[model samples]
Target: MHVLTKVKQPFNFFTESVIDLDAVNFWLQKINPLWSSNKALGKIVQKDIAADDMVSVMIQINRNFKFGQAGQHHPVFVAVNGIRYERTYSLTRLNAQHVLLTVKKVNAGIVSTWFSEQAEVGQLVEFGLPYGEMTVPKTASPLVLLAAGSGITPMLSLIKEMSKTQQLKEQPVKLMYWVKNKSDAAFLARFENIASHYANFSFHVFYTQALPADARVNASHAALVTDLANSIVYACGPSGFTAAAEEHFAAAQNVQTEAFSMSALVNDDIGFVNVTLLQTNKVVSIPKGVPILAALEQQNIKPKHGCRMGICNKCACNKAEGATKNLVNGAQNTERGNLLKLCVSSAQTDLVIDL
Candidate 1:
């Protein structure tokens, strides 16, 4: 007979199960390697710094990797100190034998720490296939690109593609770049040169922290829209910056944004419950303080995760039966079960999940 006990709050499901922990870990190790490509080992040929804390690393691929849409990203797997980790970076430029990636190293991050200090020339690194939904539209309409800090990486890629393909011949391209200072602007020289070379391309740099005596603040959203009226706006930056930009273009349907943080997806108020992997008959009881994904990991059940904050959609799984509370909008999905992001979801009820 199936058990129907109503579980109380705060319990460890891993301790209750009699499954072989070693076998489960071995299977997870085997399954984890399948999600990334091991054949695409590449060597780092060159590394250049465009500004303070902003760097561009060029990798020489052994084979011609498939090209992607202008603003797509790829995950690279690297080994450091005998531990493997994955990090995603946007491609700054595409070439037959080389891929350019710009990265802003964050403090104490595993991948960033390696890239900043330990990575050397001629080292082999595995890269996943190019993936992302934010692509430049194939249209001749006017375009407005807004970016702040390292968020300029993808927009720079799109701009370079447009210039190389001559797609800007008929349409005007305007870019608004927000930076802390001139010292923190990545690819500022390249962008300036591009603006000088292309008549259709125009750019404005907004320095927020410090500026020269002659410099002016270009923070007005009204000025941005007035200059590029009717153009599609694509923005990327910190969550607050992107949100402000979105509010500015609230009436415009063509405005699309990408943020570094999904603050909307972090819910602290949800009281946690339990999740049962139906196929494996494995269960993980989550606490109110921890995410469902974290609880599962303690049981050696590692779901595929990219941006654990719900931006990359890598941790999506079918909710076979059970309810989940969304961290972003505080919406609860109980009926019409669909794909749920395990990273940002907390167990609202006893759940049966496919994963």
Candidate 2:
């Protein structure tokens, strides 16, 4: 029994140097793209053009994929023209084995354009673990969800998750979706079907470009809520709309907002700072007020990144020295040997980074 137990102990393949995992994975992927020793892969099973500029893809995720709460985003890695680009997209789980990903084509967006024009049904893609703090709260407070344009993707997921429990009938849930026109709306029929079944759940579509234009979310809309102060509000949209929602809902019990894009901050510092990349031994002068990821990309140094909004930690790197300012909150940090998120941090001084 002791001899058998000794043989059952885990083998240290790296220290023993007995096998090349990369080489093995290469051949395994050739046989089956989803077959891997340890990787989260998914295959696109269906594709639908939800709108002229929006595409909905149904992906079949593998066993290695780690599932999370409904309102989180997952980093999807795809190779276009032999260059890997990573982007984070909100996902709606269809079942234990399938998920739906919606992509909206933005101006000069490579991945979104590819999905809108060239993505096929059988293509394979890699997915990182889902990450985000915006999710359905456990408390039974009345819920108010505000979504604009593509921001409706996560709201759809959160609503579906709520529908699975008895809470959908017990709690008051309302969704206010804003779009330029009714044609641009993605899941109008689905929301309608859900509202028909549950008396406590309802949704309203606001068209901003119609003959009788519906104004964006404002105090007038807040008056529609029965009890605004006690409701838990979740808002997702463009930066301007998200900022407005946060300001308008300040009196709510809880308010969570996620902006899809953020405008670059105009820094007060006019000079430049030298940033040293330890891995490549390359030094570049970057604008003092610009985020490190953007500054590095301007110098033709592309580091792996997902969700330029700083939600995903894919752009985080080790900072050996120097100070950084948080662009999101205007906080300054001079701590050494710390991890810095390049998407949300600007160099405050000359710095060394392990990239």
Number of the predicted model whose lDDT against the real structure is largest: 2
On residues 248-278, what C-alpha lDDT tens digit does candidate 2 reach at each position? 8778999998878764555687689999999
Off by over 4 Å in 1: 1-38, 211-219, 227-229, 263-271, 288-291, 307-312, 320-335, 346-351
lDDT of 2: 0.87
Local accuracy of candidate 1 as per-residue lDDT tens digits, 214-302: 22223455365564556788888766667677767655538777766444445465555677787788877776434577678887888
TM values, all candidates: 0.77, 0.84
- Model 1: which residue pairs collide? 264-328
Displacement of the residue 193 alpha carbon in candidate 2, Å: 0.5
Model 2 misplaced stretches (Cα beyond 4 Å): 1-18, 263-283, 300-304, 316-340, 345-355
For model 2, what is the alpha-carbon lDDT of residue 344? 79
User: Where is model 1 poorest over a 10-residue stretch in terms of lDDT?
Assistant: 29-38
Clashing pairs in 2: none
Q: Worst ten-residue run, lDDT, model 2?
A: 6-15
